[model samples]
Target: MSTTIVIFDPANASHAALLPSFADIHIACIGTDHTIATFTPPLNRDRIIQYWEAQAADAVPGRRIIFMALAGDSDGQQQLAGYVVLFRPLTETGPFRGSVEKLLVSPDFRRRGLARKLMDALESEAKARGQTLLTLDTETGSPAELVYPKLGYTQLGIIPNYGVSPVDKRLNPGTFFWKQL
Candidate 1:
């Protein structure tokens, strides 16, 4: 598999056009994969679009950074396999920390180390930008929660009822993790 990681540039119309594909990934994760996220089935597509569009509004260097994984399919067409986001303060001053968001790998692309690769790139990029620490949270016992410590992230703590599962609509505990760059 030929996989390439690209930093999203929403200022470019072509790049903005790809936002729908990104949303589709999230939708699949929730509806098909039954992953825990900010939403569940019977989702409002417009809400996802708006949320992603707002990211473009905050696309400044210090405000947000979105990285997307693209791979060539059997048909020789490139598709989004996964993506990750790193967000810092908008002022670009007095902050050496960033928050990790949306570390998503398409179900079809799972077990391929794509999430690891995306995280590796995110850490490298964050360090390059002078960030000293990164933080993220995921469903307490989810696969993602288990993967972080393997990526050098230290568990902070777990909060009960931090999120709702997409599949069962049950309140779930969430685990927080952090890594020093």
Candidate 2:
């Protein structure tokens, strides 16, 4: 199967159909106690779709959130293999900065380097938009924590008892990271 990364278009019905799977991936992450899922609330399929729809409509060059999906094509069918979200402030002033959120890959797609590709695309887009820094937080000791440093992100230290673990509902530490563009 060939996979391609593209900006998610909420206006497209085909694209919208991908949300349920995305939500499932999200829940799975949470269920696994991943850092990205720390403190994540319960998932609601309809609400998730609505939220993405609103986000897509509000997306702009710098001051908005954008979602990029890694899609797989097999025998003329497309499936969302993974996705990531990048968010930038809407203010007209101050240093340009953005944050990464909700990076997820389907279990079947793991070990295929899709997450790295998504991060690379996000950083490139942030730089193109003149963003000077990118920030993100992942659960301490999570796979993302390991990956961010490899991607040139500097650790900003770990916050103890930062959030409730989605899987166990117990307190867990969170690690913050930043990359300068």
Q: Which candidate is the best by TM-score?
A: 1
C-alpha lDDT of all candidate models, in order: 0.86, 0.74
Clashes of each: 0, 1
The local distance difference test score of model 2 is 0.74
What is candidate 2's lDDT per residue for 112-149, written digit by digit as tens? 88888888888888888777789989889787789889
Q: Total backbone clashes of model 2? A: 1
In TM-score terms, candidate 1 sits at 0.91
Candidate 1 residue lDDT tens string, 21-63: 7888888888766778677878888898788888867875448
TM-scores of the candidates in the order shown: 0.91, 0.85
Model 2 quality (TM-score): 0.85
